[model samples]
Target: MSNRAAYETVLPYVREWVSYKVWQLRVPGVQVAVGYEGEVLFDEAWGYADVEAGRRLTTTDLFRIASHSKTFTATALLQLAERGALRLDDTVGTYVPALVDGGSPIADATLRELMEMGAGVLRDGHDGDHWSLLRPFPDEQELLALVLDRGQKVPAGSAFNYSNLGYALLGLVIAAVSGKPYNEYVRESITEPLGLRNTGPDWEPARADEFVVGYTGFHAARHRRRIDHVDTRAMAAATGFHGTASDLVRYFSQHVIGQGTLLTDHSKRLAQRKAWSATDDPAGRGYGAGFIVDRIGDREVRGHSGGFPGHITQSVFDPESGLVVSVLTSAASGPASLIATAIVRLLDAAADADAPGTPIPDGVDPATFTGRFANPWGVTDVARIGARLVEVDPSAPDPLDTPTRLEVVDADTLRMTAGNRFGSIDEDVTYDRAADGTVRSIRGGGGMTSEPWSVPEEAPETAAGLR
Candidate 1:
């Protein structure tokens, strides 16, 4: 199916699912935007932006996108590289001499290592109490002193250790090379060029009222206490960014294939290529230049996730499908990442539903099809619903997602019925059987193969009622 058709099928369900999640998680406010092809296909806001004021959240409200600023920083650096101003292999000391002369390991690390989080720089300084809001975020003097005093925690080119300090140093590099303030250069070079009005380096005092009120104490109760927003001065390139979900989706569009106008093909590839694996598994997540790289089924997605004191956000771009989703939440503890991921899964399911294989005759007993299947993505439960068999992701946050009725098409194949409440298109499930006819593996519509889940005799009942 075309992306537009897939988007139309998935959007309604995504909206309902997101609304259900906001209520289920007791999230104070959330904004979501989805981009398909070259334009936004879905934009929505739910819950209260200010719970005490009884103010409703709007999609235009600014959110502290936190570490998402890394992408901007990475983009700027890549632009500078394309101009022959610097090279990714250049050491930090090449731009900032104070760090090198002060015997800091970060100074010796290459810029590429810093962007990919392989520099092994300290995540935060020794006086990292700033994260607890005890003190103001570091200024240039303090930022430099922190790096010089604390130095690096691990050897350069070591294992993947995410370091905000590394990005902050890149911020310094941008200033030194471009002869412009980090934020000013980014605005002129990146945000402004892309026509993003709502995105910026940090909070603006003039726009304070338009910003979503962030909250703390989320873990203790649904109603969290308000948290004060602080200006991340020197760290703006690392953790200080503000924008709406729609703007974020639009910004990320620059990373999509054939949609990018901000960077050249070489630079885009440099930014998106996996530089270091975040997980040990080959198929697990990795860090590209400034983006998190991972796979949902067989498709690859590149983007960044951000977290600040009172806000959390996630953005993902599926280059193959040209689908971008951004989720922003007011509470730091909110399930922004989960909600974003669930949306992507739904989009994938919708696309898969458009093509259902031909059906064969039914011969196998329906009871034999009832079992839990396990895969890298998650668990899929196949259970007998009355006399009908269905498949469902019971762990999904939204309870309204209707199960796909499974019809036996052949001895080992089942065809998913069309027109489900979840809006997922029809697909097929094929089972691998052992010599004695015991199910070995179950392959779902999206090419996800799952092994039969071994269960204990005293385990909970695994039938349709579980949903």
Candidate 2:
């Protein structure tokens, strides 16, 4: 099936799953957006932006987006490189002489190393109390002091030592080379040219009220406390971006080759190419210029994850299908990656149903057999994706991992045609209908009964020390 067709089949399930997960896990709020073939196919939000104030979250609400700023920083550098402003192999010390003057080992690190996190600079300097709001983020003078005091802890390029300080130096390099402030250059060259109205490099006092109130996790605490938004100061290039989910997916979509004119096709390819392994597993994960090279289902995706004080976010793009998914949340401990991965997995299932080898059973509308059912064991979702029906365990971390394909057995009976060893293959699933032609209950293998399940009308009550 075409990418658009697959998205149509999977979008309904995506919405229901996101809504259920947010409520089940007691997340403060979540905003999700999907981009397909240069267009946004699905955009939705759930839960409250401000829990205590009872403010419902909306698609337009801005999120901190923290580490996602690295992608923007990387893109800005690549743009400058294309214009013959600087070279990737140039040592950062060539632009920022403070490192050389301080005799820091990081002075020898190249721009490429810093962008890909290969530089041995300290992750967040000696003290990272700013992350917990105990101290203010370092300014230019303090950042220089931090670098001179304890920035380089290991030899450059010895290993993948993820460092926010490394990117901060790159920010300084951008300013030194372009003769314009890092944030101003990024806005004029990236966001403005791409028409990204909701995106910015850092917190804006003028738009303070436009941002959603972020909340702490309910770990070891009776209730989640609100986290005050603060600027990342000199580290804004590394961890201080704010935007709506819609604009984020749209911005990343430009990275997909030939999708947008923001960056040259050559630059996009270089940004998406795997430069170094991010993990020990040979084929597990890797890193590009600023993108996280990983897999969602069977498709390789390039994107990034962001974690601010009380906001967690994840964005991934499937280059093969040109499908991009972004999940933004208000709680610091939210399952942003989990929700984003599930969306891609569902799309993979829908695309599999269209494969020539897997023939979808005909003469029985899969929709009639699709609905959420509850038994004493747990909840089961019979989702209809592109004319195929699969039983999904809603609570699984990856819902489509071991799907049970249901086939028509009779008017009211279905048979499990395919599944893993854990599933009961060829088992009959009979359902009873009410007078109005609505399903009342279902009887599966071993004669276990399940009734229709619905999400709660309101958010679940929070228990002490637990959501």
Q: Which candidate is the best by TM-score?
A: 2
Per-model TM-score versus the true fold = 0.79, 0.94
Model 1 score (lDDT)? 0.80
lDDT of 1 by residue, 190-226 (tens): 9998889999998799988888888774466544677
**Residue 92 displacement (Å), model 1:** 0.8
Worst 10 residues of 1 by lDDT: 458-467
**Model 2 Cα lDDT, one tens digit per residue, 1-467:** 67578669878988888887887777888999999877898999988777666678899888999989999999999999999999999999999999899998888899998988888889988888888889999898888888888788888778777788888888999999999999999999999998889899999989887788888886666567778899889999999899888898889888887788778989888888887887788688888888889986579999999999989999999765678999999887889999999888787777774432233466666667788898889888888766577788888888877778787777788888788746577787998999876999998745699999987666423411123
Clashes of each: 1, 0
Residue 375's C-alpha lDDT in candidate 1?
88
